[model samples]
Target: MIESSHTSPSAGWAARRLAELHLAAVFLTRLPLPHLRPPLPALSAALWAFPLVGAGIGLAGGAVLMLASAVGLPGPLAAGLALLATVLLTGALHEDGLADIADGFGGGATRARKLEILRDSRVGSYGVVALLLVVGLRWQALASLAANPLSAALVLTAAHALARASVPWAMVLGRPARSDGLGAAAGEASLVIALITLAVGMVVAVGLVPALALPMAGLMLTITAGIGWVATRQIGGYTGDVLGAIVLLSETAALMAATR
Candidate 1:
């Protein structure tokens, strides 16, 4: 009998990709999966799976929205619950980053000072205001879409996937601002990985909201590029906080575009 071992390489590749995706999910969300070694290289290497993980988060949140709405809850309340679901799903990981970036960039006078503020555990007035405004915008957008729960779910799912894709594009935007930490450890994704991330995100987003894809694309590109530019100018390069802010900002913008 022939060993028929020709399938080994492709099988192995699939296994590795699955493991990488699992790793990406663990890093991006508070999902309960078996523990695996989180080597920094592996985290950055798994950037290609960012959209997949994000889609899962969005789906979970959207399901909550649909369920709440189906139960006869008010649109505002259902939308609020949906937003809460995603926030708790990701353990507020990106929200913390957004706050930190806001506090750091708005409060610090020098580059070193800005970096110091970013590392602080305490939130400032700037952080508070940033969170309120951004999260409020998200709530309002979700409420508007809640009129049609199915449509809201689709838009939310796409927004999550597309926003995450922005993170990888940023990897190639500028060098890391610090010598250590998640940002530097993440480093820059290779062009292939970055492009694949973008492609997957676009495919998921467009497939979900075909008619709104054009507007989502334009808005996402503008916000992502604008955030990347601001991050580079303010701190010399991307940090974890900056990337987190980008995801939230881009996601909100996409949702708004879909609602519009």
Candidate 2:
């Protein structure tokens, strides 16, 4: 009963649209649609899927850690595997963002200067420190929660989904710092998708940690808004790096909250 864009309602248009959307989601996330070629519209959908992608990555990481534990892997080794899985799954995209943001915010004397710093590929002292702290915090949090594999998995899934959701909100609430690049592509629908993802993430979190989900969601939202404001003020908008930093920080915050 669906129609194609080129045809009437009987042409399977809705099905095709859904297919395009799925392609976009796979491209943006880790859904493993290996056969489809990446197209612009699909890429657009993928952008919305970024948070879901993170959630998938988190789920995989947790599952790996759980499996290792079941098979009697050492606790440290299992935790390390989970961490490594996350890194590999995301290709450390957000980690790089966090570092860039740190360098830009720490080393620049003015807002314009900060934005310039973020564009630079060279890492700085602030970047190094920030990366170290983030990695350390994540490791500690995961290790502490290792005893409860299911809880850890839930935390990872929730964190990733929440982190990605921040990107759309940032795109909606803030301006794009540059005329071109990834940030500019984020539009109103993307922001809506991000909000919906956030709501779903919160629901999942509540199921895992009933006493803490509400407060955690509030904290995540507050931090996301603060970061967006800072980025907007500094660069007149956001860039891919800013979005990445938001994801990293939000995820870390969620992890910490769940542990508490």
Candidate 3:
């Protein structure tokens, strides 16, 4: 019986919301689902449900790492397993985005060319470097926080929520690079969804550390705005890869900031 202003109540809100959640899963991960044409509606809803998706990822990662530790896995090994679990769960979708973006920006001479480069499947040197740095940073961060798994889990939760929240703001402020693409679908993401995402992010932050919630919120806002600015200037708009890059960068930045 839950109703969201953005979607119809009479259209079986529960079913629609569940569908949206499922769509979010599909967008973020490699979860199997029936194919559908015109994935915009589902993708849009997925953007809104990003925080929940992140929570699920956090729970899965925490559980795996804890289980590994319980079985006498070393802290470093447990952390590695948890990281691998996250990559596998998400199907490395964001990682692919990050790599493509790196290749595009590094190789292209013009904006259009950059976009074209991003669409290419082949990875370049810049992409390889970017992947290494991102993965290495994340692994190191988790390892540093290994002594406190609860805090590590909270960090992951906050990072995922805040990272996804950046996409809506980017869409709102940036132009679409093309007449049609993932960015266009993302641009169609509603304000209600954005608000929902922000609310969820705040809730996760506050739940993690009551005293640090305000600071974390401020950090999240600042990082999101910064990334949005970069997306606008560099690409002259947003794209799926751009959104993915935002998620990866924002999450890394938030974790780094939180640690300090």
TM for every model, in the order presented, reads 0.95, 0.83, 0.86
Per-residue lDDT tens digits of candidate 3, residues 1-260? Answer: 98757755767677667777777777777667776444335566667677778767766777777777778877677778887888898888889889998998888888889989989989999999999999888777766766677677677666666666766766665667777778775547667877777787778767766665666556656765676677667778778887788788777776666666
lDDT of each: 0.88, 0.74, 0.74
Clashing pairs in 1: none
Order of candidate numbers by TM-score, starting with the best: 1, 3, 2
Cα lDDT tens digits for candidate 1, 49-162 = 999899999999899999999999988999999999999999999999999999999999999999999999899999999999999999999999999999999999999998
Number of clashing pairs, model 2?
Answer: 6
Query: Which candidate do you rate higher for TM-score, 2 or 3?
Result: 3
Number of the top candidate by TM-score?
1
The TM-score, computed over Cα atoms with residue i paired to residue i, of candidate 1 is 0.95
- TM-score, cand. 2: 0.83
User: How high is the lDDT of residue 175 in model 1?
Assistant: 74
RMSD of 3: 4.4
**Total clashes for model 3:** 0
- Per-residue lDDT for 134 in model 1? 93
